[model samples]
Target chain A: MAGDRFPVEATHIMMFARSVADDNQIYYDEDYAKTTEVGHIIAPPTFVQSSAQFNPNYFLRPKVGQPWFGSGKEPTGVKRDAGGGGGGGGGGLHAEQHYEYHRHPKPGDVLTVTVRPGKTWEKEGKRSGKLVFSETITEYRDQNGELVVTARGVGVRTERPVDQK
Target chain B: MALKASQLKVGDTYTECLVEDLKRTQLVMYAGTSGDYNPLHTDEIFTTKVAGYPSVFAHGMLTMGMTGRMLTNYVGDGRLTKYGVRFTSQVWPGDTLHSTATVESVEDGIVNLKVETRNQNDAVVLSGYAAARVDS
Candidate 1:
């Protein structure tokens, strides 16, 4: 339950779609969905984004006990962190996202998730100077060990913490 | 209700806007369904006192999830090549999110879109896009 072993259930897919107000037939409507290329009810394109849920240690979640940029001193030469996407707040903010879908997630599919820290660099921002950008890539694999999706995200953290509350 | 990827031309727009509430229950359901159970999205006391937020807000993925519907429902049963978003502002309960997606370019049998999502005050809360391959 901590990591890996994410069971893909039809009900969860349907509910996830519904939670976002998306009722696409491919996610439900078994009869119609079967007529599509997937031949089964499938998860949406961003479904793999939920892969973080499978592992509590997955980055991007709150209170994961990891040293996030802006929370502490900058690592020597800005290293690539493969895990620990901890507690997103001001200074460290999610800036961009990307997903490459090899295939749609289907019911009964057990997705194995892996998170790796990619490139971390710095730049200047107009409002928030010295913005450090970090990229975290999460990969999802199916039961047959085929790549299903890859999600790349960029988080921008300012050098100084700005509190609104 | 499905269109071939070839049929999707640049400038095609998902005119039917998507708007939804950031309900606490909806966030709870997402936690149970997605298994990301971060208290910042559920526990009011934890988010307010501990995390120093005004209240429990929706997950950034939840915003991406909602904005994603605009594309999925429009593309209908088409295959998705890519979908993503940048979480700009905190989505609080009762905030009405409005979303839109426009076809920016089409190439190599793939359709690219420009997406915009704003809250009730017309402030951008999320920004991203999608690319999907179509079949005849």
Candidate 2:
């Protein structure tokens, strides 16, 4: 669990603002941001996923299954098998993510993010054997401790066979 | 003055683009700021040896942000009423992302549009619909 003591910076906010294609002057223009309800440039809803507060080692590479990569360099470091003291395993894939926003994100506002494992279950698939679906609940709050957004999504986990695309 | 929903025809199109480094440094920064630490994005060995992805990739929400920016820029403020998206594919580092929207339908004061996010290859990475209220 992280604290509000560490707030998100302005530069990162701006970077994410621009990254979400065609960000408007309201997010980049100081004059516009000052007059808006948020009183500062607000971040796009999509920027919620960029937070670095959570440790990637836990969610990105769970040791139970292998993650499917399209075609890029492989990720390195970290103990891939640290979950429950099991032998190292494979990676997983993000199946879906959904976000609901209460208010637009603004500049100069301190944000505190908290992430928790939402749920875990299994289901049978056509092509794949039994698949595991994991969901995580991510909540974002403003400097005043108001709930700004809530995101819940599933990540599909399965073992990567040697010759499967 | 609000644009009239009746004026927007189906099949209308809008586009935009941006450039940035989608490297681990930025990923780490986002993870730290956003509280998303999925190893498929930040860890290499875990991604390769375990996950089997070629390299770490960008978060789906990061791509969706690009989609939202397109709408805000196309129609200006107070114009976008409702927006939603479904992630269909994964985007990797250094991949140039492009977003576009096509008008789908309009009823009464409501206007519908099809929003899409594609990579350099023009593959539809994310596809969904958007609804906005036209000021009469």
Candidate 3:
């Protein structure tokens, strides 16, 4: 979710809500939502998480052509070529997720995401020994350039698994 | 939505929503909708053989999405100023989760809540907090 702009539209919001099976009226009915606290139809709380779909620079888009933990492809760290996280030996899993929202996102908002550096640590696991955890922090700013949300996505790579490809 | 700024107080426990089932199709649709093709979440074989899991599990975002549903349903839209959660366990195919949001505090027309989601077995799988501006 670093340095990519995601467009907020009713379609994406509706699809995300449907995919997750969230029937909250605030995400749907405009007339009903306006009668509530928000006064307008707005996205679900985690709707900002959908930015991964449009942000090519998102760290965990796929195994093919995404960024990796120790990959030195990006000399400057912010700008890098695609396919660093690509290949046959990739089995990273999202371990934890946390989000902070300044405002509920609505349609017609353009948000820019920027990935900031975070800490990395090691923890021993029962199934996978000595796993390494990396936390990547992402910030999304609205079209007004005001910050709307900040997300922390943690990824885990197992060191004990021999066939983790 | 029984919460009102004037009537609310600290230690008030209120609101929950079922997280529904963890079906394979739900994960597939989420991968398509979210563009996260991570094999750990989408590929059954890869999840079993490579990641050393029993089967493909729901994306952390999927559970987080359910948690979001719980939050929005409780405080309504535009009230949630902050919400965050941590995944503690894997959600298998038939598992169901339910989360409750409890009022932690009240100040300046804002309601702060501590939220926790548990599996059918009463295991806490996700826990977090949310702060909402409930002035009206």
Candidate 4:
């Protein structure tokens, strides 16, 4: 995901924390957060993934007046190839994710996102068919251009729907 | 409170029940917040009939986010310097998750940990590692 300004807001952080079932005051309560070592409210470890909300062309999100891939009057709004995977119909599934934090993001930090392709490889799987994996590296830098978080994500596309055990 | 390297040992571990019974609405919440509106995570008909799964499942990132709570609670908020994970298996509704962080080492005010999240059946859903700043 690439964007010029991904504003990290307090309410978004609160909702994101709630969705993950995290009740930590450091995410919501400023009073409690002030007493912590960070001395202020800080974003959760995986919170940067929410930057997808700022990605205008992110395919997973349905656009207005556009045919979405999800269900409507039928099982799906659009026709897809047969034998596609359960997650995204050859769009692939997330296989792995890694993050290195130069520092935890705070509420007011406006981050600039830059993405680059990493690597690709293939592996035969017992449960699924030919597994093709690709990686992407994303860097989140603060307004001052200091690297805040570096993220590496791997996605795998299967030959068909994975066989359930 | 942050962890102190002087008080920690290589084999020390901390665990938390991340979720008791996963719900589909929680998946919706995560999708809405994370902007990952992939139908597989929130659409039952599309998932079961079109994509071919028994039912809708949670996003791997959701599991990681929940597991992060466990980590921050152990190492203290804003203490983590590195965290990574591999999606081992699918997490479905009604599954309970338990996450653990085991201290692998502590050196020079830094602590490295082995992280793992298991379902109620003891199946590993997410496996990972993390590093954090600790008091000397």
Interface RMSD (one decimal) of model 1: 6.1
Report the CAPRI category for model 3. Answer: acceptable
Candidate 1: regions farther than 4 A off: A1-3, A56-93, A123-132, A156-165, B5-7
Tens-digit lDDT track of model 2 for B14-38 = 8877435455665665555455556
Over A3-28, each residue of candidate 1 has an lDDT whose tens digit, in order, gives 37777888778887877668677787
The candidate that achieves the highest lDDT relative to the unseen native structure: 4
DockQ of each: 0.40, 0.30, 0.39, 0.77
Question: Which interface RMSD values do the candidates have, in the order shown?
Answer: 6.1, 5.8, 6.3, 1.5
Candidate 3 Cα misplacement greater than 4 A, ranges:
A57-91, A161-165, B15-17
For candidate 4, list the clashing residue pairs, or say none.
none
Candidate 1 lDDT tens digits, B1-136: 5556667777877744465565799888776666666666776764554345677778777788777777777765546778878877778888888788888887777778888888888888888888877554
Q: What TM-score does prediction 1 earn?
A: 0.79
For residues A1-165, write the lDDT of model 3, one tens digit per residue. 347888899888888888788877767677887787558778887778778787755555534644432223321122322323312233455677777787778888998988886989988777656778889998989999998888888877665442322
TM-score-best of 2 and 3: 3
Deviation of model 3 at B106, angstroms:
1.9
- Model 1 chain A weakest lDDT span, ten residues long: A69-78
Q: Write the per-residue lDDT of candidate 3 for residues B61-86, one digit (tens) a residue.
A: 88888877777777766677777777
TM-score of 4: 0.96
Task: Summarize candidate 4's per-residue lDDT along A7-79 as a digit string, tens digits.
Answer: 9999999999999999999999999998887899999999999999999878789889877878889888876
Q: lDDT of all the models against the reference?
A: 0.71, 0.62, 0.72, 0.91
